[model samples]
Target: MTITRRNLGLLGAAGAAMLAMPSVVRAQAPRVVRYTHFQPGRLDQPKHAAALAFKSTLEGLTGGRMRVDIFPAGQIGPAPQVMEQLRLGSLEMAVVHDGGISGTYAPYQVFSLPFIWENQAIAWKVLDGAFGAEMAEDMRRRANIRLLGHADNGVRHFTNSKRPIVTPDDMRGLKIRVQPAPVFVKLVESLGASPSAIDWGELPAALAQGTVDGQENGVTNILAASLYQHQKHITLNGHVYSLHAYLMSDRFFNRLGNEEKAAVLQATEIAKVIHRGMTTAQDANAEPILKEKGMTVQRLTAPQIDAFRQKAQPAVRSWLEAEIGREWVEKLLSATRAATAG
Candidate 1:
């Protein structure tokens, strides 16, 4: 029973009634939800705030029927391992970056395609529109997981201590730190950098000890992690838009009474709003704060950015086709273009 947008309209009416069953009502009276994130208690850490907000909203929505137990700072496992735990039903819920777990659901990589989103507003519209909902349905079918929705982490920009990366030629020969994921490594390598796979937990120390000369991330992340202390310049390459997911195990969700299930989904949606608001707000305020902390933020112009896309797109798109399917990549690109225009 694969879900599609058309079929969902029919099922939704029938589903709504069952979603409020008495057994569900009873079960959720003492339901427990386990949530986790790698970010600690920093005001700039949106995931941390999303966890707290979800707990407060879910319990309130359920009239104290559900209790949320959240683990912060990667207590259970690293970023890549969490999705497997969710699929096996060992973990209840988690907020994770789409890039880290796209191996399990290759279609999710559609969001991580470099230079796809022009800005957060356009990205937000697509994620909140039918496309995001459709993607969530697809994930449920493929990976037995529910994408609660997209959460913003800001635009990912390049940072380097070696030299200013104004163009693709500048990225050459610089060994940059990359997430322990193939797609990210491929993106950096496509741009001519020596991509080194690194865990998020060790990035701070890696930077501090000069293990890696540079990396790419959002302004909010750079400031929050104090990466400015290691990397001398921030090039607003804005290469990729950073997106995280508020994910739940479909198996676990399916086992719940309808009302309990809805409660959980509703809570996840609330967290999405919290996550987006905090992260975007952080990015909005980061320029001044980053300047105060002595980090130089450089914005690239059209000609320079065109040079980057031309150099990197062929390799990145080719890799995408190899990993997934050519047809799928074409579909995603088409949808993104449509999303962009609208």
Candidate 2:
């Protein structure tokens, strides 16, 4: 309670000691990132592969000042919940599919317009260009989530236990499981299949239990979830060029230091490349992969694919225009056309 010369001297000495150990005084706890994805944490899974690359590259870039903790296969929660966590900054990052994103940013469903992309190359060009940048900015503003980059979810194709879908007519009367997105629902309906809105996690079970006769997904997902075990046939319709969005919480990102931010952005781009490459390879070899899995694989000719496009494209596009507005619909159409032309 009394000021003493001895106490004053001791306090001064402590201050001097602290000053002498600058590194100890200046050291801060590492920033932790809680990253998540829907796929299992296996090297074979594109999402997990990309996630590992991201974690290593980011930590290395930041000299361990930043740490990433990955939660794969919905360990944190389901897609909708995970997305909400990201938006609220409770989760730092996610590599979410387009269907998962649609619940948060409805306009993202514009990408669900069937058969728009001629090939993965055309899709990549549009996603890596101004159109993608614009969409990212808009998503940041609307959802409080930053879209770092886009990767392939795979070019979606139809698989069924009932029949090989060679034409739109062949799709009739079968119940197909689709992501719980309106565009996908409309797409299946347009092809004359009865669509059952099923969660991705429930898809294999749905097919196995005969809750749905078939479902559509990319080759990467089919193998990742082993849906091929349930579905007997796959048609290489390539109906939709699906996407996996590299997303970060804007709240978390905005608080980062300049150098940390740079590292994250660069690391995300690297992950995006890995994710895209792995998924694209699987999609390119869909027939062989599905056949190896002991499923019947049907490869469509150009005319057959065109028939699918004619049937489903307009229906899905119309639904998208109605839900998200024609502006985004047209924007995607124009972007794809430009990408194809180039």
Candidate 3:
């Protein structure tokens, strides 16, 4: 065991190798992101399609330094549970509907202020601008979730088994199922329908079992969930321009290197565009899609839609002003006006 010059040199080389091995292993190991959304994993489904694009694009961008494992159709859990996981850093990312986002950040419900966005373009302008940035920052501060981007959840319209809702009066005395968010409940109540708060997982069963006569959703969701099979009628009132928010856990995002973060942000923008395009196409062709599915599709006149808006907007705005704050409600209104003008 006497140390010679050659033996000492060999020991030093082995020691250096041992020290470098850990760093090499760490560099070679890919960071796995658990991404989830509440849509079927089929390519036809918007969320899944976007998710696939994100996975491929991000992996390519990072040259395999990152790997995304997607859990579509709520494979891990329902929206609320998935969101909780995201907040706690058990999950890395999610594309969640506004209703689910509202559960974590109540200010998100301001987007649900019934008939706020006249069209998708205006909605996008508002969401991609300063107001959306401000809200994203606030959400990060409050909920520890980073808003990557906002995409269309589709323009929500009313669907019923009993009758076609041509006006606010037609919605009266109907039991309409809505997402489990207070703003939706208020919106339905304001329009005179009895709103039943149901989780997305339970909605199809609720319609089939007559737990609720009808429900409201966008074209993409109707096609995704097959809600059109149960609801014989749909009113394309475009009452609410819904949103699917791309979210990442602040804990996970902050841990990434600058290049990785940039790749993630760029990949999310790509996915957001795909999501919005698919959903927007479905919304634009809603009438034909529903009619082809054997559902009675009702397209309301601007005046008819105006009547519903006048009735429901004020009521929901008042309720929201009390719930979140008048400042948020007013901020959205002002943004909408500016976006519309621009």
lDDT winner between candidates 1 and 3: 3
Per-model TM against the reference: 0.87, 0.94, 0.95
lDDT of 1 by residue, 1-342 (tens): 789998998789778868768777786477778888877765458888888888988888778777889898789898668988888888889888766668678877756578877778888877887677888898888888878878876778788887777878888888799877787888999888899988888898988888888998876667667788998877877678888888898888887777877877787888888888888876676667667888776778978887877876777888888887787677667767887887
lDDT of 3 at 237: 91
Off by over 4 Å in 1: 1-29
What residue pairs clash in candidate 3, if any at all? none
**Candidate 3, which segments miss by more than 4 Å at Cα?**
1-23
TM-score, structure 3 vs. true: 0.95
Tell me the spans in candidate 2 whose CA falls farther than 4 Å from its real position: 1-4, 11-27
Candidates 1 and 2, the one with greater lDDT: 2
Q: Pick the lDDT winner.
A: 3
Worst lDDT run of 10 residues, candidate 1, spans: 282-291
Better candidate number, 1 or 3, judged by TM-score: 3
* lDDT tens digits by residue: candidate 2, 1-342: 997999999999999888878766456668999999999899999999999999999999999999999999989888899889889999899888999899999889988988888888898899999999999999999999999999999999899987777989999999999999888989999999899999988888888888989999999999998998899999998998899999999999999999999999999989988998999889888888889999998999999999988888888877888899999988888998888888
Cα-based lDDT at residue 196, candidate 2: 91
Model 2, TM vs. native:
0.94
Against the true structure, candidate 1 reaches a TM-score of 0.87
lDDT of 3 by residue, 83-116 (tens): 8888898889999999988888999999999888
